[model samples]
Target chain A: MAYELYYWDGIQGRGEFVRLALEEAGAEYIDVARQSGHAMGTGAMLELMKSKHEPHIPFAPPFLKDGDLIVSHVANILFYLGPKLGLAPPDEKLRYVANGLQLTITDLVAEVHDTHHPIATSLYYADQKDEAKARSAAFIKERIPKFLGYFEQVLQQNPGGPTHIVGDKLSHVDLSLFQVIEGLRYAFPKAMKTYMSNYPGLTALRDTVGKRPNIAAYLRSDRRLAFNEDGIFRHYPELDLAP
Target chain B: MAYELYYWDGIQGRGEFVRLALEEAGAEYIDVARQSGHAMGTGAMLELMKSKHEPHIPFAPPFLKDGDLIVSHVANILFYLGPKLGLAPPDEKLRYVANGLQLTITDLVAEVHDTHHPIATSLYYADQKDEAKARSAAFIKERIPKFLGYFEQVLQQNPGGPTHIVGDKLSHVDLSLFQVIEGLRYAFPKAMKTYMSNYPGLTALRDTVGKRPNIAAYLRSDRRLAFNEDGIFRHYPELDLAP
Candidate 1:
């Protein structure tokens, strides 16, 4: 059976990470919430989320249903799918390393989300713009450099070489890193413009993942959603600072 | 050999989650940052974090070193340690479920941290008290109930029953959940006073885990740090509004 991906339809959000992995490996999967028809769409996704029968009720979306098993959280989903999709390192230990790197990406993404919604997710962005501005300033100045620089160093120091994040293989960590760099560049073009040049290894990795035949095709496909204000990576001109 | 746990010495923070799991399992581990001696303490921890040779340099602390392998992130470390410490479900599939639950807790903990430092982690709480108040209001009114309620439902709906979060075993998920409840109650006693009644399953789980012999002992020991302003969960009377 094809894998069922349950995420809110529209912006890529966290689901994009899973989509990139699936697409890269040419795996059969359904973007369940994006499909149109009976028993499809966001209703189906929400229904599963609220379903009392689901023994493993996910706290949020972007969960994967492989047969009867449901895997939630981006890093957890990737850890489970990586080996099967051939998007992970062959060594068992390196796989854990990949998962750790993916979790680091998860932390960075959460911080990015908070930049635009500093006061409260319940409040309008307009109401919290002041807080957002301060948060974004700190995020741009401190966090982006800390996280991306750590990743850059990791890439440069990779035993297999700087070609991939773990071992010699182009694992899901690389794909997620590629997506993160893309999202950051889109969300903070001004800040990233100055900061991007500092991390040459990450820049090369981003380019390599983007140019992958499947990823290149996927990027052009309708299935790939554009980054918007509603997504994890939002571009508000005022929040974008100079590094 | 003892498992080496590295995190900030003073605050419970994220490290408490891992500590709870280890304590419950009676696992022999060194709290490296808290230890006093040559080749120990926070300096040694920082040295390893910036070590040029470590292929897997953890993005931050609360990382565990097992022999030569280093595992980072609370959930990742627990996932790696779970089986070895006999604190995870025996079923391989349920291990993922436990991990997913642990990751959800991770998300909740991050949100809790933000309630006290909404504007920026670099800035002191005094500098962003206004933003923190607004954020904490929403957190107490919306996020706490939402997250805790979800966990309550998951526990009640567990196939193994409400005794544990995953399977019939007392897993790391249970230990983490216990810490979350403890933290929330400490942080927002007023809000949780009303909210606690609605989550009897979680409340019971918290109590059960607390009464467990090892956990009870650990709580009385000096090893368990007290919750303070420096920790993830902080009690600011202004932020702890009535639910």
Candidate 2:
């Protein structure tokens, strides 16, 4: 049976991380919320989240359903999928490292979300724009460099080439790093461009992951949604810095 | 071999979740950062966090080093420890539910952290006091009810007694729930008092978890640190609500 992915019908949001993995592995899966019929809409998604029956409900979208296993939390979901999809290393230590890197991606994603919604997730972006401006400024200045620098160092230290985050082969961490770079470029074009040159290895890894046959095919496919204001990584000119 | 828990020396910050589990399970472990001469200090912790050696470095503390395996993130660490410590259910489905509950706790913890540092983690509480006031007001008014209500439902829905979050047996979620209750009482005493009586089942669970022989012993032991201003759950009168 195909794995079932339940998330908002539209926009990438957190689900894109799952999408990238499923797409890269060319796995059979259904984006349940996106279906026109026999599936729940965004309203249903919200209701399920608020439902009292499923006390073990997800706090947010991007939960995956594989047979009976219902998993949410981006990193947690990926931890289950990595080995199943052949995107993770076989060795236990390497798997732990891959998972550790994915959790770091989770931190980066949270930071990205915070840039736009520093005050409250319940509030609108416009309501928090001023705060976002200040938060984004710090994020671009301190957080981006610190996070990317760490990734760069990891690449340099890898006994394998700098192509992968964990080892010689592509793991879930590489795909996530690629996504982070993509999201940053989309969200903060100017700032990313200004700092992009500093992390050449990261840039290269991003390019390589993008050019992977499965990923490249998936990107060209209609299943890949465009980044929009509704998504986690939105492109706002004011939030971007000039290179 | 004892699990080596690496966190900041002083505060019962995020690491407390892990510590509570180890304590309740009567597991052997070393609070590495708390050890003198043998472990890294705050500066070393910061440097290690920024070190380029591991691309998968944790974004923050509460990382666990068990033998060669290093795990971070509160929920992730618990996910690893839950089963190892015999605090998780044997069945996979039950394990998923426990993890789901743990992830929810993570969300609550993040929201609590944001109550004081709404604008940015880099900014001081004084810098964001106004925003925090607004944010904390919302947290008290909306977020608390939503989270608490969900936990209440979990207790009500449990085929087992309302004493556990997952099943009849004690799990890491129960321990974490106890910590959540304790933290909320410490951080928002007045606000919590008004709602405390409403969730009797949850309160019962908290009280029961606290009364567990291992937990009771741990709490009385010097190993259990007192909650203070340095931790994630801080008590600021202006930020808290009245009963």
Candidate 3:
């Protein structure tokens, strides 16, 4: 049976991270909420999140239902998928490292989300323009460098070579990092232009992941959602650093 | 060999989540940064984070060194510790559920941290007080209820019972949740005071976790750092909701 993935249909958001892993591994899965004319639509996603019968309840969307088990939180879902999808290291020590990297990526994604919604997730960008401007400034100057630089160093020092983020293999983290670079570029093209040159290894990995047969196919396919103002990595002329 | 935990000497911050598991299990471990008269001190913590030789690099503190393995990120650290400490369930499926809950708690902690520093982590709280006040107001009204209420639903719906977060057993998620409630109360006594009665299940779990023999002893001991302005959960009279 194909694994069922639940997420909003409109944008990639956090769901795209999981989608990248599934695509990378060539794993059979159904993008439940995103499917066209499906019996279980967006409401099904909410039902699963609010489902009381399930042993685990997802606090939000982008959860995975793998036969008997349901997993939530992007990093946590990736943790379960990484091993099965051949995208994570078999060595226990290296697996933990992959997890740490994924969690940190989750952290970066949250900060990126905050740039668009600095004051409150409940509030609109138009309502919090000044706050988003201040947030985007710091995020571009400080957080982006700190996070991307750490990954750059990790890639530089990788004993197995910088082919992947964990050991010598293409782990889930590599896919997630690919997504991070993609999202950041889409959201803050001008701001990232100043910093991208410093992260050659990351840029290289992003390029490689994008060209992977499965990922390349998916990118060209209609399944891949375009980045927009409604998504986590949003572009606003004002939020983007001035040219 | 004792498992070595590296974190700052002061403030519970994120480290306390991992520390809680160690204490609850009465596990043999050394608080590396807290040990006095040692050459390592806090410098060792920074050294590890900056270490070029290690395969895994922690972006910040609260990392664990277990023999040859190194793990970082609070939830990631707990994911490693939970099973070893017997705080998590023996079942594999249940373990992932526990991890999902733990990651959600991590999300809440980030919001709590941002309440005091909405603009930038590089800037002081005073530098961003106006932004913080706006952030905190929304957080108290929205985030606290949303996170706490979701956890309450988890507890109330637990198959094993309401006492624990996963499979009727005390997992690392439970200990982390206890810390969440404790830190929030210490940091937002006024805001929490109004919402406390609404989350009796969570408050009860916190109280129960505190009274656990090992935890009870740890709380009274100096090892458990007091909540302060420097930590993730900080209490400023102005930030807290007024009586």
User: Which one wins by DockQ: 1 or 2?
Assistant: 1
Clash pairs, candidate 2, are none
Better of 2 and 3 by DockQ: 3
- Tens-place lDDT per residue, model 1, A9-44, is 888899999999999999999999999898789998
lDDT at B91, model 3: 88
- Give the poorly placed runs of model 2, Cα more than 4 Å off: A50-55, B43-47, B50-57, B159-161
Query: A4 in model 3: Cα distance from truth in Å?
Result: 1.0
Ranking by TM-score: 1, 3, 2
Ranking the candidates on lDDT from highest down gives 1, 3, 2
Worst 10 residues of 3 chain A by lDDT: A34-43
Per-residue lDDT of model 3, residues B97-212, tens digit only? 99888989999999999999999999999999998998999999888989998999999888889999788778899889989998989899998899989988888898899899
Error of 1 at B239 (Å): 1.2
lDDT (tens digit, per residue) of candidate 2 on B128-221? 8988887888788888888898888878877666778887899999999899999999999988999988899899999898899999999898
The positional error of residue A219 in candidate 1, measured at the CA in angstroms, is: 0.6
